[model samples]
Target: MDSQADLADILAGEPERIATGFQFTEGPVWHSDGYLLFSDIPANRIVKWTPDGKTETFREPSGNSNGLTYDRAGRLIACEHGNRRVSRTEPDGTITVLAERYNEKRLNSPNDVVVKSDGSIYFTDPPYGVSEAERELDFQGVYRIAPDGTLTLLIDDFDRPNGLAFSPDEKSLYIDDTAHRHVRAFDVLEDGTLANGRILVDMAIDAQGSPDGMKVDTAGNLYVTGAGGTWVVSPSGEHLGTIVTAELPANCAFGDSDNKTLYITARTSVYRVRLKIEGMKTF
Candidate 1:
């Protein structure tokens, strides 16, 4: 393939609309079994769509979930906005609460989540799900849940922490602040703690979108949902370009057997595009 053509393969064609008519869609994840699962926040449920064009409900009253991912053991991990907690759905179809309170106060709302290879669960807690009167936490935070079920506050300085992901090597963690319109990187310490936080990218003041959800490819490039569409940034923080979508995307994930297909969850719909690059495997 021509070099340019090879690079252009990141998007096979116009984004294919898999389904529509949802109240609001977010948190798309591809299953190895040939289907994609995503959340319809306002509908309070998770929907599954197959490659063959089948759509069905995977779970109901999904706590108004916003983000979803699979753990090493194939359990479903979710960030619930309505319930203001992070939970895991076991293979046996049981739901287990992972994190809900910090220092005896209820969380503002768990907005996005990702699983580390070491079995640690990381998620962002913003107050988007509840009103100021119902929010018990004073500040938004990024939290980590250890394998032993211990919850630790990783960072609490963000105005609105929305999305999070780890570098391919797991040596760094990236967290985005919607209110600040910037993404920050942190060094992952040997003890599963984070330090050395710094701004990775500053969206231009005139940029069209605020930073929301993010994912990293195998090559360390970040696909972050922001103004105009998904902003693609190199591992070194260089602006590559943006993937424009018909609707504002909330989150994205690489799926398919090859992990080269990007599934996007936008308002009222879900879309997918085939990319030449593959996503970093969570397992």
Candidate 2:
């Protein structure tokens, strides 16, 4: 990561492994209550990590949860791969099914999710958790669940929509297609539908890994986990640098009180690295 030094203001220190021994880690979200939660996909669980370097099971048999985020109200919104639905974990610990089917057809697999400032929820549906015969939606899609309980298909042509995030101003939605090995930016229109879809960055130049999970900084820079590491791309779509990790990281989140710590969920371990920039939090 020679280019990393060019953006040294972003990376404060090298990534350090915090915890290990998980099946397949993904979906890292920082809670305001001082903890980091992430999914161990094949293990069917969600793990919580603390600043003390302790690990605990936040949820077992999590329906194979993938991506996770907190709504403005601080409630957990999750994409469940095994359950084929998007669920919300309420403050009282009761689970609410936000989105499970569209047009009376079951979803393929909700791979990742994000919450809008308007209380709306968005998620990507791909068939990574199930077989072809088990999938109901013929095409992978990016969907939005309105606060009124309406499910709307935002984009349906993605080859394999894996991860997604909204810009700081909520003006743009960035989604990555793992199959296509590229990230696409979409205009978040007034009606919550998308428009002006365009490729933001292509990762084909790096032959190591495909795009999976993504996050953005306050400066509008995108921290996408792919192409052999975490690609730090400028808002204008320039690949500025990379945070190459020992293990192939699947997802990342900004945690700690100041939101200056980046937590990465690699293959079998959780890693953390300091950052000079304050990352955008869930709320």
Candidate 3:
């Protein structure tokens, strides 16, 4: 299938942000309450951006939080690289630990996360957020957190899984393995197990630095972070045109009233662009 699309067709023009002043940010999530929550990794805090452009701190020393998502209950789920765990922010702003260890060893670092309709949590763990010794886990893994608070290791073999997202139908999962310069796809099994893992898109060594974060649109188009800009791909692994921008984008999500706003987390700043294709969150 042809997976290429001109980003210019969907986006009316360059994005106008709702917030700013972060030190190296990543992981952006849009909530039903009309607020955007994101992480400033180096600054060690989670910040909120309202539709009116007001910004506020969500969490202090956020364990170098890298990714954010919301469960069915509207609670904020965060992937903390510094603490090497995934946590949830309660409605009252209190924090709750979701997963920290597996098989008696601490995780390397939870890099990104996404929630399923059934209240299951899936996340990627890499070593970028951990010290050499503190990361006890030998291999980076993609894990699942059941509603009952059980942790299941989905995949243990990955160079460095950075960002991830599920297909609109939830039958497929797309994951970014940065070091290998490729995005892999997995078939989601009936029991929430993943199988048939294969390389979905092989990124160029020079054209794209590394795929960091990604999002899928309503039509199953995949928008991923690359060196130059965002690489738009099809669900079947075809390469689409790049979403050109000033800064190197790290991650993205569909937000705004119609879910047509693509919020991107770049180097030290955040940006947004309108997309012709609304994101899967709205689909």
Model 2, span 121-229: residue lDDT tens: 9999999988998887799999999999999998999998988988999999999999999999999999999999999999986457899999999999998899878
The candidate scoring highest on TM-score is 2
What lDDT tens digits, residue by residue, belong to model 1 across residues 1-283?
2121334635565567789999989998877777889999989999999988889999998999999999998889999899999999877899999999999999998999999998999999989999999989899999999999999998999988988999999999999999989889999999888999999988655656799889999889998888777877788887677777789888888888999888888888888878878898755
Candidate rank order under lDDT? 2, 1, 3
What TM-score would candidate 3 get against the native?
Answer: 0.94
TM-score, ranked from best to worst: 2, 1, 3
Backbone clashes in model 2, listed as residue pairs: none
Candidates 1 and 3 compared: the better one by TM-score is 1
- The regions of model 2 sitting more than 4 angstroms off are 1-3
Q: Pick the candidate with the highest lDDT.
A: 2
Which of 1 and 2 is the better model by TM-score?
2
Which regions of candidate 1 fall more than 4 Å away from where they truly are?
1-9, 205-207
lDDT of 2: 0.92
Give me the displacement of residue 202 in model 3, in angstroms: 1.1
When summed lDDT is taken over every stretch of 10 residues in candidate 2, the lowest stretch is: 1-10
Clashes of each: 2, 0, 3
